[model samples]
Target chain A: MSLCEKNIFKSIFDEWNQSIQRFIQARKIAAEDAADLTQECFVRLWKNCHKVSRDGASSYLFKLAQNISIDHFRKQQVRLKYTGQMASKSEKEDGQYLMEMQEFKERLEKAIDGMSEASRVVFVMHRMENYSYKEIANQLEIGIKAVEKRMHKALKYLSEQNILKKR
Target chain B: MSESEDILLSKWLQNKLSAEEKLMLEEQYDLESLALILERQKTLEIQTVSSDQLWDQLDSKLSHETKVDKNQSGSRRKLIWVALILLIGASLAFLLLAGSEKTIQSAKGEQVRHLMADGSIILIAPGSSITFNEKDWSNKREIQLEGQAFFDVEKGGSFVVESNQGVVKVLGTEFEIWESGKQMKVQCFEGSVSVGNLTGAEKILGVNDAIDLNNQRFSDVYNHGQLEATFKSGQMKYRAINVASLATELERFYNISVRLEKIDLNKSFTGILVLNDLEKAVEYLSKTMNWEYDLNEQNLIFSSN
Candidate 1:
């Protein structure tokens, strides 16, 4: 690559690398896996640099990250199936309470999965990644009210699922 | 729950609630359930990784790959040079046999009018260009356009104007095509034309019909009563167009950079923009939009007042 192309690629990497990783991590991927996926995303981006315009770089990177994370998740599921390993359940003194908690967790996950992508992303960014609403608004390039609205909608939808009420 | 209460609960989850708001929320909702849900959500938090360290790893990997690519390309350089020279020689010979392609370009703040061999006319907008093979014009009426242009095609075989955003094909029509960035606007003033985007989606527009496309998707479809392009009459007119779109036109007309600061770009503007005078155009826009602007050599910044 020429110095100019290298500079462009470096700038794009610097601008989007952390955001892409955070985006993947927010989807419940481990930090290490998110980093690897982020690296792969950038590699694909660099390979296809000629095809992507500078103006569309952010959306392209995000779309690439989303696909990479989804593929990684699918492969993980396949590996788990082959290994016959289930997710470790939480251990508690009261077996009945533990069973109820596990069921509630599953329902919560289901509720989150059923949310609109926009609302889910906002919710996960705030809840899992601990991003402030203002920070999320800036990162997503949306108004603060939009971020709040999505948060409200997500929480409201989850509350409607009655996961906590079961307890 | 009420909208305001939901917003308050959301704020509480972020630990951004004031003492009074917390009291209000505790009194209204089940605080125990909220706390339980928040505690369980902690299990979903992914482990945090150092961004700088990851970037370091990525940088090393990229540089290593680059080195490999460079070494491979170095060995193939001589062959590529030879192939390029041969290709250039062949192309030169071919150009000598078949006449060279012709290109017409309009400079900043200028419009160029060209009459084709088949009695068709094209008015190229400022800072725009079109290229075609004059030798094959009769057989293939195709021109590659960049930026904006108004075309009046004579009734004949299919006339095609290709742009980066979309392709306009017409049998006999007068139409204006404005292509810049990812947005392409096609307005058919007479006859009919079919506009096909890079995605293969196509729209046939009759007289006075117009369509605006963004990223190969239809954004706006409308109709106008204008007989021809307004720019052809020494003025540009827009009806309820986005301020950002208008800024793009200004940038092309004046060959300047337009930057918006703290301005709502979605705000629409409807008026005539005089193409000949930059000062008058800015004055009119500022007065109508109630905006303050700063102009510093080739750059114009518009900010909300």
Candidate 2:
């Protein structure tokens, strides 16, 4: 890549990649897979940087990352069919599994929405960017104790809501 | 789910757990299920990648692609661009059907530009929304809109944008479609677009062709379709639209409730709706329509002068 192109691409990546990762993770994609898709999203951004407008770039990156996760998730669903082939009839297990997944997702979304605004943003920063308690506190201009409290509260809320799947 | 257990789990997540503490948690949940839950927890709390490593990965991919396609990169670049978007769209559309409906909504005072996995681009205006089977997009290339949007569609298969009141079908074109409340307008800026109302009657619009629901006639809104365009400088431009129609649009644009009581229903105005300044909007509308408006806490109230 040219120096100019690299510079442009770097700035865009630096700005939106963390939020993109968070968005993917919010959809329940595994962290590693989200990272991979985040990279892919920026690579496409680099390839078509000229077409992207400054105001539109962030949303474009997010939508691209989201679409990648959806695609990746669908492929995983397809793979699961092979594993389920042996145990039960396709019709019965498929319907039940889909409903369970949907319900789980809805609950998780509700749990996040129920969190206080600061807690939710702090939680996203902690999870998406892996910020430490001190880092989140410093970034949000809050106390470290407050950060820890919010993080713990968010975790507890999700757990209590039974939003995360238990094996 | 005790406080102690929560602390331990949070510590383990922070990688502060020692060998023994890890084993203790493993013993508590058992190794397999514990591992499964921990693995799933990463989704809620993401694992961050160091920026340096991510940069290297991106650099390597860029170098590899450039080295391979240096000469014929123009056509190949186009192919990759189109393919990149198409792959994302086709896959997401698949999931939208199997998973749930995927809808794109834009809030007031914001515009979102979405590039489909196909090469088509959709520029959604504020206070507008659109829905389509994300899963069916690759195959069907159809979408439903609730506000106004300018679609720059790539030439290939027929793409369709449906709204509450009408449908727009096109083979490869650049056009703007507005569908809100009882107002629906489609303008073909480039190529040709076919529009069908709630009724089945259809009209194919060539370049510069515009058709409104209120007017059955198809006419020219722009001359020399080759001329480029830019957004309306934070002001929504309206030409000879009714007060009621203007009210609905202002409600969407400002994200504020507008009550047009005590005013002539048929009074029409042609002017600009300036964003960011309620005073300017009041000045413009009241002057143009000879109407008085009161800006309230939650709503804009209008009355006859």
Candidate 3:
């Protein structure tokens, strides 16, 4: 609640507002709707101003603008779809995500399980356990290039299987 | 694109591109190809988006709408490394330590709130990590800290946080510990905690107590009430901290690479940084110091004007 913090917030808002407005405009959101989205994003930033880092603010603002704009575009259809699909279910934030991942857990395992042995082991070490390529290569007594290749292979496998989409 | 270009694109997507390498990519590749690769890479991240309908409902109900035009959202990308955490977590469940010796980490721009088996809670900042033996939770309740964290401990026998240079012990208190590079910083908001180095040096800190490598202790360092929970609101407090130190902290939480030019490294500023926008934060820093900064693609470089 310090003036310094408030000043900091004001400065950040002034600096990024125009660009975010432009981004929202580019998305074809009406000026008023764009303004509303921009305002909502900034308001959310102010409310949760303490939880985020300084250098991450602008992108955060843009992300809010982008999502809000997207939702604005999809609102009518999305509302109908949601009410039709979810009217019977009690809304649970965590449950929604958990349920989304319900089938994904086994699918994720199957994707990994189907990888070539070398690629599978490398994938497990790098992706799951969070080991570095250097460490994984050193632990397995393979070259770093080999490790990268296997990881690339594993990723390619996942992409082919549609575990990780190729876009 | 050549194999090297493919690798370069991958590194660019991962944001592992060094300044020189990034410059090379921008110079050598067409925007179209880069966008194509980037568009493809974006699909690899399977992050969850917020429920617009639910949030709209909530927004309509409790409306203390801001007068000032403002917008903010959590950063869309994880940035440094791609992590489909739920997918990885579901697969890595067996890899977790069983009895004790557990390590908890937050990836860059990721905040992890971990509840210990005991009622104590550790909220780790991004690019920060912590490790503890869960078996000792009830007995001594010790944890080893690597970067920065806010600890809210239950009234237990004793809660301890061990850093590379020092250790903090408390019965029950709210405090923050940041161990950056070689320096250890401890700030206590409420109750009292005892902190000391491994060589047996120690001090007792009470409410509003602050200490860092530069200043051993200070009575009135911050102007905020209950400084420990301020981060929950989306702000970071830096007090008389040098530019290099501040830059390092920015890289940790903001997921940005910051480097100071030769002339700007020595300047120190005391300020609160609002993390509502990244570019604006850089602008604030540059404007405050009367310097110039350039954003070349992913890197934000600040230099003397």
Which one is best on lDDT?
1
| Predicted candidate 3 versus true structure: per-residue lDDT over B1-305, tens digit per residue | 44554355436545778998889867865535434432433222211123343245324522444322222223335522245776577456635644548799988766777877865667887788899876656776888888888987777687888987788998447788877655667778667788886667677777767666443332333323332344443567676677787887777767878777755566787777765467777888888888788876567778888
Q: Please give the distance, in angstroms, between residue B166's alpha carbon in candidate 1 and its true position after superposition.
A: 0.8
DockQ values for all predictions? 0.17, 0.11, 0.02
Model 2 clash pairs are B85-B117, B86-B117, B93-B134, B93-B135, B94-B135
Q: Which ten residues in a row have the lowest lDDT in candidate 2 chain B?
A: B224-233
Those runs of model 3 whose alpha carbons end farther than 4 Å from true positions after fitting are A1-167, B1-100, B215-224
Error of 2 at B152 (Å): 1.6
On DockQ, who's better, 2 or 3? Answer: 2
Among the numbered candidates, top TM-score falls to 2
What i-RMS does each candidate reach, in Å? 12.5, 12.7, 14.7
Candidate 2 Cα misplacement greater than 4 A, ranges: A1-167, B1-100, B215-233, B275-277, B296-298
lDDT of 3 at A153: 60
The residue-by-residue lDDT of candidate 2 on B189-281, one tens digit each, is 677888887668788787666777654433434432212112222455565678898888877767788888788887777767776476788
Ranking by lDDT: 1, 2, 3
- Per-residue C-alpha lDDT of model 2 across residues A1-167, encoded as one tens digit per residue: 33226676777777777667666665445566777888888878767777887666776776676446532441110000111222235644697765654454455556665664445556666764577888666554455655665665566555555554543
Q: Per-prediction TM-score, please?
A: 0.41, 0.45, 0.43
What interface root-mean-square deviation (Å) does model 3 yield? 14.7
